[model samples]
Target: MENNLKMKDMILTYIIIGIIALLGNWAGYHVSPIKALPGMLIIVLITIVGWGIKKILPINLPAVIYISLIALLITTKIFPGSEWIIKETGNVNFLALATPILAYAGLSFGKDLHEFKKLGWRIVVISFVVYTGTFVISTIMAELSFRFTGKF
Candidate 1:
């Protein structure tokens, strides 16, 4: 069972997915694929580290938490060469990265129409409320940030 669980398919799937995501991002930015390497490497490396941490800890800490922490450390003074890497990938729009992911989500959603329909209009209402709240909060935060920087 353990051997089956650790099959190459799991790792290969991630590698393929990561490469596709990186390629899509590069295409969107019209940059050479080499330029996207650092960001792709960072993401893959961080994901492995996060998965390891998630496995070891007693608490049910998710992989995203660990990845976010690593990303935070890199953006700070802790990780050398992080500034250059961040700057290099800064122009890569996140929406481009999210496109494939969102597409996958839509496909997955379609696989279970019964389950989806069971949620009814509540899902629509909740989604609307959440998006509205997010927009309001983000706009407020941006305004505050600009005001602090004297750019508002």
Candidate 2:
């Protein structure tokens, strides 16, 4: 079936990404690939399960929502074996995972430039305003939090 093929492709893609992330982790952060393998496997499993959930659920929702929820649930104190999950996943450097993802995002942005150009000037102006507003708001919130926590 087409769905099976899609799942197979997804699994293969996740494994490749995981391997690249592990290598990045080793090269950039000095974490051995052997040490990070468990964490990477767990992450891949979580992603696959999230995608599976998205397919099974009738409601239209992004796979990220399911992925985040699953991650949050498993890592929370109430979940059984939460500590072990946290400990293993902590081996993976966040930046290691982010590098490939950010690279992909950059490529996607480049690919979508034609579509992006089709949008009018007004949309561009609105996007800039929204981006600036979000950045300002986030900065203010971070400053306030740091002040409250006496971190700065």
Candidate 3:
């Protein structure tokens, strides 16, 4: 019963995330081209707000919000003339690149290395499986789309 509940929760979480992602992607695609800077700013603002709210909110609201914000950011980057907008945005990439390092540093400083060692193999296996699965699924989807649409 516990495992079943866990599976159900996981499935529901993924479904919510998927819906948020789809909506965010659609919004970004339509809005980013017209208002690149404003769109990026909105996304950054949303992410910051979500992070702040995460501190006080229960459940996975923060994760869903963060994912949607990140999707918007990526979409903004893909917009035409985004290079100039990014340049004007002033070192967003530097902050972006530093985030993961900062997170790793915080994790390393907060957690004992010995504890991580016990789960290292499990982490490695999960990472491998996820990466391979993503690659396979994306490749298959790309091929199918190209085959059906006659375009790459």
Candidate 4:
């Protein structure tokens, strides 16, 4: 019963996010909402499927893992109808979707300020270390890729 309620809430939330992304796509990218709706709906359907898969599977894993897997598989050349899916989804500007998603992430962080405060300075130090490591690794990878491809 609880799971069903959570599913409903999640679906509603996805729909709301899709609507907001559509608005953002129209306003920021000059794409008509009507034109983008199909792609938005396809994306939302994929997300719902991913969420459902997470719920059905017994293993403990993040929904994002499932969502990303689903998206990746459907868009790959090996997948049937991949071209159509890719073409339809291309109408939606990714940045438009990212803006609202990032805004919500920021809001979530703000809501967790108390929990964040309890971590004290350790979180800050860890954050810096993690960020620096990520930056260094990313730079190295980018340089290697460029050298290998003879693009630098």
Model 3, 1-152: lDDT tens digits are: 32233444544554444334334444544423233444345444544445555545666453556656654564496777656555544323333324444656897774676666777677979988999999999999999999999885
The alpha-carbon deviation from the true structure for residue 91 of candidate 3, after best TM-score superposition, in angstroms, is 6.1
Query: Tens digit of lDDT per residue, candidate 4, span 18-102?
Result: 9999999999999999999888999999999988898899987888898999999999999999998998899899999999989
Q: Rank the candidates by lDDT, best first.
A: 2, 4, 1, 3
Best candidate according to TM-score: 4
Q: Is candidate 2 or candidate 4 better by TM-score?
A: 4
Residue-by-residue lDDT tens digits, candidate 1, 1-152: 32234435556766777777777877776756677777766666766777667667877766689878977788776689878768755645566668878878998986888877788698879989999999999999999999999996
**Model 2: per-residue Cα lDDT over 1-152, one tens digit each:** 32444888899999999999999999999999999999899999999999999889898888889999999999999999999999999999999999999999988887889999899999999999999999999999999999999999
Q: Tell me the spans in candidate 3 whose CA falls farther than 4 Å from its real position.
A: 1-44, 52-60, 63-87, 94-113, 119-127
Question: Which residues of candidate 1, in runs, are more than 4 Å off?
Answer: 1-10, 119-152
The per-residue C-alpha lDDT of model 1 at residue 113 equals 82
For model 1 the TM-score comes to: 0.69
RMSD in angstroms between candidate 1 and the native structure over all alpha carbons: 4.4
Q: Clash number for every model?
A: 0, 0, 0, 0
Q: What is the lDDT of residue 67 in candidate 2?
A: 96
Question: How high is the lDDT of residue 45 in model 1?
Answer: 70
Tell me how far the alpha carbon of residue 24 in candidate 4 is from the true structure, in angstroms, after superposition. 0.2
Q: Note the Cα lDDT for every prediction shown.
A: 0.73, 0.93, 0.53, 0.91
TM-score pick, better of 1 and 3: 1
Cα deviation of 116, candidate 3, in Å: 4.7
TM-score of 3: 0.37
